[model samples]
Target: MSVTAQTGQRDGTDRRAGADDGREAIARRLITGSVKRSYEPIVDLDWDSAPVPGRYFLPPGALSLVGTELWNQMTVEQRIELSRQEMANILSVGIWFENLLNRTLLARLMSADPAAAATHYALTEMGDECRHMVMFGRAIEWSGARPYRMVLADRIVMTLLPHVLRGSLLWVAALIGEEIFDALQREMLEDPELQPLISRLMQVHVAEEARHIGFARDGIMRRKPIRGRWETFVAGHGHALAGVMLRRLFTNPAMYRRAGLDGRATARSARANPHFQDAQVRGFASLAAFLEEAGLMSRVARYGWRRGGFLR
Candidate 1:
């Protein structure tokens, strides 16, 4: 090879090495921060204290039927119960996503450099996820709400879209699971009207999720880009559909039945409710913009985002 060609190749290699070193430094920092701030949710949260009466588990505006005529007909007690149920449902989705993330993290470790700080951080993050899942289940128990189950269609779609949690899309899915909910819960955490127990729960989850989001976003920005239009299309659409389904999993049909509402009717109303759609658009706005700017979004992904109420 010509001397100039060799020199250019060497420069490229050095730049890549520098980038990897920077990422390792970030992971090492995260590892240290995690050790300092990680909470043992079982002891950190007061599990034995009963929920306060006349307080909301989540904000009124966060509920699916908040502004609808149907919501207006419900008694204040019913509305509070509905909020509790929805919070439980949110926890259910959180558990599912975090559990999936643990599995994905372990899988990633198989081919990763075992001694790398990034690999060690992935292990540390999995510990955080385990505690989050336990916290979620315990919080649902505290609210006296059963764990929400995903709808059949959402389950089927997840079964079909394996790629959503592989390649660059894995980090995208992680961000989807963590960021939107974290953003929405920030509003919940600040509200004094929130139930005391729930206030603590949100604080713990949100604090840790911030770290997890950083990890995912860093991975996405650094991962190898997908090649070819077909591969990009598959990644975009598959991820888009997966994201839509993830949102759907937040509302369990059984939650409505337990709250004394007709499950099907309420589900339909919630799906069409302008308030719910607006909340989704608002809550997801930042995450969607970030992914799009990262070039992770495609034309089909944009359509899916709109359909999912994640974008205007």
Candidate 2:
């Protein structure tokens, strides 16, 4: 593919219409094919892989209380159900990102002058995501669980919408998604009860995600601002949409249902109950703090943690 700049635009004006757009398409196509390529978990991973000695997952002073409280609140059956769902969510993480990476490659391939550097990065990312899927899938299987049914929100964001937006949004969405995983993975790796296989999987994932987070930060920062009033309006709406999708994942109905609460009722309670307000509040606050600590709060426009109490 050609690497020369296209005609008609001034220096620094990104005239590559399809650089972001086409790259996403190319990425999705690649991911579809990659997913079809299979690997055997039992054959590849040692079932007896010894756990990494000492706490390797949780960050110091990280709020384990929240997760413990949330889990403890649920009945025994609820805990098992939620555990299954959580495991599925964990396994799906890499699979979903792999799909996004594939779409991005497609977009890059379609660009008028594709950046070799970007394509190379995408290839590495594709491999990382594949490894992540395998590791997570094996962890789930080892726990005697199958992947959870795709919820409506997941179907919409992870499944349906990647085709509609440009690849840039994928990176934007990814920045949020990966950061969440990075945070959680860090915590899980430290967990005493955590299986050795799961800890190793998280460790490997965190290593790869560090690069992805950097790429997403740069990609989101390089985008042009929305120009006109209508464009600004649309951009605002887009932010709202993105925020809603994110909040939905955090406040997943399956999460509540698995905890023995009615999924819808738990969602409603989360919205309405003051006693449980800390769940949303503290969650966003912790996330915001992480963003600020990582110097990302200013990068993605202010996350809506201050006024709304939650991301919704």
Candidate 3:
């Protein structure tokens, strides 16, 4: 996309200042939505009947290894087992991401005016994330799957990116994490072949994440006016890299090892799988659309997004 096309978004010129009150109204509506729809996983989920046999913990198609040659060789039981471990790892990584999100939000809140409605909504989102972390932890325990930790490189990248790309990329990255998971979970919740426990967990998550994504998208729009050319370049590439990183986090080699596959080889196959890449393209469609509309998808950034498999 050209610079002219980027500036053409929602009427051509920078509109951040005029969008402030509108952003606040959106935030207020999100708070109301959260109050009405927020869920308690412990009280709401059935703890005794988890891991119900003959059902997948995630939809088969959502698995990174699915449709690859290695996955074709797995027995029904092996497939289901891998799904359980993969889902656990995804949830565990979610917990890690949520911790970062909470801290980032609190740090931003410190400078934000306390009386603003956006600050109140940020607090509400922090509370929702706290509940989600506990919910993910319990699900991991009940499903008998172990949590997966970030690799050293992943940890280092995650730690530094927030500081390096504070305004635009930071918010866009958070939005991607929430929306990509929400997109997959929406499908899982409706999949009859999945366990009821997994479906219910997704139900609660998807319900609340709609509001979170809204706030993040709104934030990006508001920040567009202040971001200069260099800042836009940095944010664009950073957002692309962040999307790829989040996708990698979901497909752990440890999951393959636990499921009795050759971890390294299976991970390699998953990375090369055309079906998996297509799933990523589909999963990230909404996010890509948002970036384009928000005037964040510059020509240089589009290169990184294409390299990252988030665009193309």
Per-residue CA lDDT of candidate 2, range 145-223, in tens? 5655556656566555556545344554566557756765665575665545666566666766766676665554444
Instruction: Show the lowest summed lDDT stretch of 10 residues, model 2.
Output: 56-65
Error of 2 at 99 (Å): 2.3
Over 1-312, each residue of candidate 3 has an lDDT whose tens digit, in order, gives: 888777777453446545767778988999888888888887998888857788998889888878877788888899999888988998988898888888777777778999988889999999999999999999989898888887888788667655564778778778776888887787679898888888898988988888888888878877777678876777676665565565566557788899888888887788778877787788778888888887777776667667656666
Angstrom error of the Cα, residue 75, model 3: value is 0.8
| lDDT scores in order | 0.81, 0.52, 0.80
Candidate 1 residue 304 C-alpha distance from true site, Å: 0.3
- Per-residue error for 17 in candidate 3, Å, reads 5.5
lDDT of 1 at 294: 72
Pick the TM-score winner: 1
TM-scores, one per candidate? 0.91, 0.62, 0.89
Mark the regions of model 2 whose C-alpha exceeds 4 Å error after superposition.
1-45, 48-81, 112-115, 151-160, 224-237, 255-261, 266-312
Task: Summarize candidate 1's per-residue lDDT along 1-312 as a digit string, tens digits.
Answer: 999999988987776787688789989999999988989999999988988888899988789988889888989899999998888888888887887778777777888999999899999999999999999999998889899776676567545444346766778878887898898888778787789888898899889889989988886676443234655555566566754664466545677888898887788778778888888887788888877767778878888878776777
Instruction: Provide the lDDT at 72 for model 3.
Output: 88
Per model, state how many residue pairs clash: 0, 23, 0
